[model samples]
Target: MKRYLMTPGPTPIPPEVSLALAKPIIHHRTDEFKKLFDETIKLLKSVMQTKNDVVIFSSSGSGAMEAAVSNLIGESQKAITINAGKFGERWTKLVKAFGGVPVELKYEYGDYAKAEDIQKAIEKNPDIKAVYIQASETSTATAHPIDEIGLMLKEKYPEIVFVVDGITAYGAIDVKTDRWNIDIGITGSQKALMLPPGLSIISISQKAKTIIKQNSNKYFYFDILGEIGAYGKFTPPVGLIFGLKESVSIILNEGLGNVFKRHSLLAKATREAAKAIGLKLLSKRPVDSLTAIVMPDGINSSDVIKQMKELGVEVSNGQGHLKGKIIRIAHLGYFFKPDIIVGISALEIALKQLGVEFNFGEATTKAMEIFSDE
Candidate 1:
């Protein structure tokens, strides 16, 4: 049976991008690869919506996150971290791992971070050096108010660096990195770039570069400054770089505005369909990238996931303590309206097979209506 990937990360890759990945590899140190790398960086800035310097890493998105933390914050320096979900909590761990003190602003899993909360934290600790947050929390399918927080920081704390993990937001959501005053914006190739896992991209502003120059962080491989100035510091992932070029070309060809609208429509259709089937949404502030639905009482999300897999559909289960309680269906990357319809159809069948009581056909019908109007 053919499988459908509807997970948040490692999302479905486009055929064109897959083909690009299969192309003959080139030596990273040569002029040909350097030209491709430079073109890819330019395309990356367009997608990131930033005029800042961008760098590509051969590691996962978490590697860029670590680079942001380790390069910007020094030992004994204080920073603010938002912990609204699994990825949000990563900021806290990274800060602690790098010997920086983290003033964690914790929120409920499905909730979003408020600008006021961050402002309050900064007011309480005026010595904070940086603020780390996620543009979209993948685990909870929630989106934080990065614009509000960034603008607030721009007005109040001009010296403090603003780092955002836009791993799930970059291509799916319109995150105006430069306009939002995000000093460092990070994303992964797998989430919204319509490519396989292997590359991570980060946009660094001039302010962030200056901060890194002043800091004495003890990191060699994650050195952001060294990665700048012409070519990457180490041997780059040549195949993934070629794939990224194709992926960004596809995104640009579709136009970023249309890409975001397509994602929004798919997410809305999915959310409406879930509600029509009597399911509750997990995220209070849902993102366009994915929809997280709370499983019915006494229904295990793992079982639902298993049933969907048996039907050749793949969705993700909640992480950490919420596992087996919530199901996350992704509409990001290469997904379209028909994908959502098929996913909802499979979900309806799975729920019925599990003996859950709900209107069987209404979900698909509602989703079709939304897609028709789109």
Candidate 2:
């Protein structure tokens, strides 16, 4: 069966990236790998829209997330967490795990934390050390307004570090790290970087570096400073790093503006198609990365996802409490207009097969029209 993946992550690696991964491995201490590693860092810096030090790790994005908490905030510090979804709540968990206090500013599943909420949460507690948020919450399929929130935090509370989880937002969306005053930004390779899983790329501001220097956490594995000093000299997943090099090369050749434009257009088309098919969106404020559609009144999202997989098209089911209510269709990374068409087409058929349809071909036709206009 021919498979087309509409899942958010481990999205789909391009043929060129796959071939690059297949190349013969080389010693990490070699000059050749060092050069490739340096060039990869340069491209990553451009894509992140920051001048800070970009560090690559051998773990998933969550590793970097934990690093943010452990390295920035001390064991006794009280941090303000914006808990809007599963991933947002992760900050709270990480804080607790590291013996820190969490002053959580929470919102409902579909809703996002507002600027006022963040301001109030931080202002009400003067002892808050850092404000943690996710730029894009994958579980809720919502993109938080990090730029606006970051600006607000910097203006009102420059002393508190603003940490962001950019796992799903980094490459697909415009994350001007320096411009936004984000102290620490984290992302993984699989999501929008178009590489396979197992690599997490992070960028840290000088301010965050200073704080980390003071913390003196005994983290030898996820140590950002150590990783920076020993980046190219170690055998740190050289294959995936090579894949990341090709992945970053492709992203740069396409240009950042064009990349954003492509994701925006495709996401818009996906949302429109789902709306045309009479599916309700799970997120009140959806983003250009993925669209999470609410299943009809009594329908099970798990059933839908299962059927799509059986049909050789795979999409992700909702996370945590939304497992049976919503299905996500991702438009990030290496996908294009044609892939969107394939996804909506499969979804329409799957809906019809599950006896929950209103029209066939309508969604696909509309998506094609939208793509043609672009």
Candidate 3:
């Protein structure tokens, strides 16, 4: 059986990117490499929708998140972290690891953060230095009110830097980094950039740059100040940079608006398909990137995942406390109508094998109907 990948990150890659990566590597010190690197960064800015100086690190998305936290928050300085899911929980951990005081606003697994809550936290902690959040919480399929929170800080707390982890949001969802006043926007190539892991990208506003300069943060590999325009400050991932150019060009050629619409339609199909199977959704404010489906009572999500994998459809089980409780399916990156159909079909088969009670055929049919109508 041909396998289908339905996880949020490490999504399927298109033929163009595959072909780009197949090319032979080049030395990073030469002018030829410089031209490629510069163009790729320019295109990346388009995808990120920001004019801020963007930098790339040869590390996972977590590296960029750590860079954002370590560069801005100093010892004993307060920062507000929004904890709505596993990824949200990571922000608090990163802040604490860097010796920064984390003022975390915890929410229920499926719930989202309110901007007013962040405002209240900042108001209470007048010495807060920055606000950290996720544009899309991958763990629970939730999208926080990024725009509202960014705007609130822009108007009321201009001095506070706004850092957003857009790992699952950048290429998949329509996140306006600059327009929303995001000082630092971070993402990984694997998530929505249609590439494999190992490269992380971050965009920094001038305000963020100034703040980082004043801080005496202890870091070497992820030096944000040293990386500003050094063109890979360290040896970059040359092959992935080539792939980045192709992947970003693909997103731009499709027109950013069309990409956003396609993700929206595919996500709608997935959500409705899950409901047709008598399963509930996990997020209150779901993002178009992926959908997390609630497993039926007495049914282990791991069983469902295993059955789906046997049928050549690979998805993800929930993380943290929600593990074995919910199944996550992706519609981001290279997915289309038929991909969603196959995913839902495999899910139905898996649930049937597990003896879970649900209307089996409706899920696949619902996905088909939505795609056919579109």
Whose lDDT is greatest here? 1
**Cα-lDDT of candidate 3:** 0.93
TM-score, per-candidate, Cα-based: 0.99, 0.97, 0.99
Clash counts for all predictions: 0, 0, 0
**For model 2, how does the per-residue alpha-carbon lDDT over 60-155 read when each residue is reduced to its tens digit?**
889999888887777788999989899999999999998899999888887887878888887789888898998889998898889889999889
> Each prediction's Cα lDDT score?
0.93, 0.88, 0.93
lDDT of 3 by residue, 38-76 (tens): 899999999999998999999999999999998888898
- Candidate 3, after superposition: displacement of residue 309 in Å? 0.3
Please report the TM-score between candidate 2 and the true structure.
Answer: 0.97
Compute the lDDT for candidate 1.
0.93
Superposed model 2: Cα runs more than 4 Å off: 232-234
